[model samples]
Target: MLPTKMTEALNNQFNNELQAAHAYKAMATYFSDKGYQGFANFYLVQSKEEDFHAMKFYHFLVTMGEKPVIQGLLEPKSVFENALDVVKQSLEQEKEVTRDIYSLVTLAEELKEHSTKAFLDWFIKEQIEEEDAFRTIIVKLSGIQEGGEYFLKMDEDFSQRTME
Candidate 1:
């Protein structure tokens, strides 16, 4: 069973994951509207993955005898200057998510919630991959001076990255 505070925290994380999914879906729409279908599909897949992550937390909370409460999500930014700018924003968001996960781990440790810490370990590892993946995209985008065939090739490359 989970402590009340831990349960609340888990629910908050679950909601945040859903918000992340919503945000990614918005980004996907933006990309699609801008004629970057590959990038849009990439974010669509990311949205699905975020939903899965949220569900994982939801299931964990259920197992702990807590009801999950999803909250309102903020609208995602849709006016990216270009594809590279969108990728830059994504990388920054991923870094922020990594920090949030670390903070949650620290909070669990401070609360002596060992199970929460253990549960968060998966997210911690996931955040590492998430950041690394975006970092690679940022690196690739950094080399392209303009959005043209290079950007298209970059999109193709980024599309190849499966969300495993």
Candidate 2:
């Protein structure tokens, strides 16, 4: 049986994932409004990926014999100084998630919940990938000249992004 503490933590992470999807959707709209259709497409795919992550947690909770609790979402940030600002904020958000996942791993280790640790192993690896992706985008955004040909080419490149 899952411990109450662990169950609650997992539920919170599940809700966080859903919240991320909402935020990504907002970012998608922000991009679309700015006429960056490729960036918008990227955010849309990211939103879908967040939804998939949430569902994975839900299913995992069920398999672990815990009833997952659903929660309402708050409004996502809709305004940004610029496209680069959006990616910078996203990197911070990803770092926050990485910290949370690491905390969960520490908790699982402390509890000696081997199964939970094993389950979270996947998330630990996934978090690394997530953070790397955001950081890479931040670097790209930082180095490129905005509103230039490079910007358009990068946007076009991003347009082909798909969910993994």
Candidate 3:
């Protein structure tokens, strides 16, 4: 059985994951509207991954004999100055998620919830990858001014991304 505090925190994380998925969907829509089909596909795949993450949390909570409570999600921002702006925002969001995951890890450690800590270790690694991925995208986008041959090439490269 899960401790009350730990269960509550897990539920909150589950909700946050759902919110992240929603935000990525909004980003995907923005990319689609801007005629960046490759970017749109990337974000759409990202949104699906976020949904999978949320479900992972949900299943973990249920397996621990805790009821998963989902909360309402805030609307994601739809406006972006450019592709770089979107990528920057995504990086910031990933950082925020990493912080939250760290807090959960700290809490689990303090409470002596070893199993919870072990489960969260995956998220810690995942956050690192997530941040790195967005940072790489930012670097690539930053190098090229929006709307050029290089930008189009980058878009083409992104379009090739597929969920493994």
Candidate 4:
């Protein structure tokens, strides 16, 4: 059995994940418009990942006998000066997400909801990987001139991480 408060929080978190997916889709469009196809593909993949995360929460809520509510997502910015800026903003957004996840975990602990904590453990590890990956990319971007061969090569490398 799940606590009522925890269930409501999970629904909100699910919607937030969906909103993050929307934000990544907007960023992908911005990259594509700037001719960074590789980065655009990266964000497209990110959007998909976010969608999966939302679904994960939704499934969990269903398993807990809670109704998953859909909330309205706000529009995200579609313009950035360059790939670095886009990814930097993404890293910051991800950090914010990590904070939210941590808060949920803490709440679960306070409420003696061990199941919620166990599920959130996966997200805690995943966030660590996400933040480190972007931090490394941001550092690499620091050395490369924007729109140059280096940028193109980096984009290609990033694109290789995507499915198909």
Candidate 5:
């Protein structure tokens, strides 16, 4: 059984993951509107991944004998000045997720919930990869001019990104 505080926090994380999915979908549409198919594909994949993450929380809650609560999400930003702007915002989002995961881990530690803490280790590793991926994208965008060969190549590479 999950402690009350841990249950509430996990539910919040679950909702945040859904919100991240919503945000990524908005970003996908932004890229698609601009005719950047590759970029759109990348964000689309991200949106799906967020959904998967949310489901993990839902299942965890269920297995822990708690009912998961669904909550509303804030509206995502639709306007971005450039690819760099989008990447920066995504990096910030990832960092926020990382923070959330860390908070959950800390809660588990405080509660002496070893099972929960072990489960959260996966998310900790995931956040590291998520932040690293966005940071890498930011680096790439910072070094290239939009509509240039390098940018096009990078987009093409991103288009190949598949959810594992």
Candidate 6:
């Protein structure tokens, strides 16, 4: 069985993952409206991935003999000044998620929840990859000026991303 504190934190993390999915869907909508189909596709995949992450937590909670709580999600931002702005916002969100994940790990450690700690190890690595992916895109976008051929090419590249 899971400790109450750990269970509560996991529930919050599950909700945060759902919020991330919502935010990514909003970002996808923004890109679609701007005619950046590739960027939109990428964000759509990201949103799906976030949903998967949330479900993973839900399943983990259940497997540990704990009930998972569902919570309401806030409205995600639908507008962005530019594609770069969207990428920047994504990076910021990833950073926030990293912090949240770290907090969960810390709490699990404090309680000596070995199984929970092992499970969170995957998320810790995932957070690193998530941050790196967004940061890499931010760097590439920063190098390309607005409305440039390279920027459009990058958009095309992003669209090619498929769920792995």
Off by over 4 Å in 6: none
Assess candidate 2 and give its TM-score to the true structure.
0.96
Off by over 4 Å in 5: none
- Per-residue alpha-carbon lDDT of model 4 for 88-138, expressed as tens digits? 999999999999899899889999999899999989998998899889989
What number of clashing residue pairs does each candidate have, in the order they appear?
0, 0, 0, 0, 0, 0
Q: Once all C-alphas are superposed, what RMSD does model 3 give against the true structure?
A: 0.8
Sorted on lDDT, best first, the list reads 6, 5, 3, 4, 2, 1
* lDDT for each candidate structure: 0.83, 0.89, 0.92, 0.89, 0.92, 0.94
- TM-score of candidate 3 against the unseen true structure: 0.98
* Candidate 3: segments with Cα more than 4 A from true spot: none
lDDT winner between 2 and 3, please give it: 3
Q: Using lDDT as the measure, which candidate wins?
A: 6
Q: What TM-score would every model get versus the actual structure?
A: 0.91, 0.96, 0.98, 0.96, 0.97, 0.97
lDDT of 3 by residue, 6-81 (tens): 9999999999999999999999999899899999999988998889999989999988899999798998999999
Tens-digit lDDT track of model 1 for 1-164: 77787788788889888988888898898888977777888999998999999999999899878899978888788787876777788888878778878888888898998888899899989999888988887787788864578888866765775666
Native-to-model Cα distance after best TM-score fit, residue 104 in candidate 3, in Å: 0.4
Q: Which pairs of residues have clashing backbones in candidate 4?
A: none
Candidate 5 per-residue C-alpha lDDT over 31-91 given as tens digits, one digit per residue, 9 for 90 to 100: 8898888999999999999999999999999999999999988999989998899989999
- Prediction 4 TM-score vs. true: 0.96
Q: Name the better of 2 and 3 by TM-score.
A: 3
For each candidate, C-alpha RMSD in Å?
A: 1.6, 0.9, 0.8, 1.3, 0.8, 0.8
Give the lDDT of residue 1 in candidate 1: 79
Report the lDDT tens digits of candidate 6 across residue range 1-164. Answer: 89999999999999999999999999999989988899999999999999999999999999999999999999999989998899999999999999999999999999999999999999999999999999999899889886689988988898899988
* Ten contiguous residues minimizing lDDT sum, candidate 6: 139-148
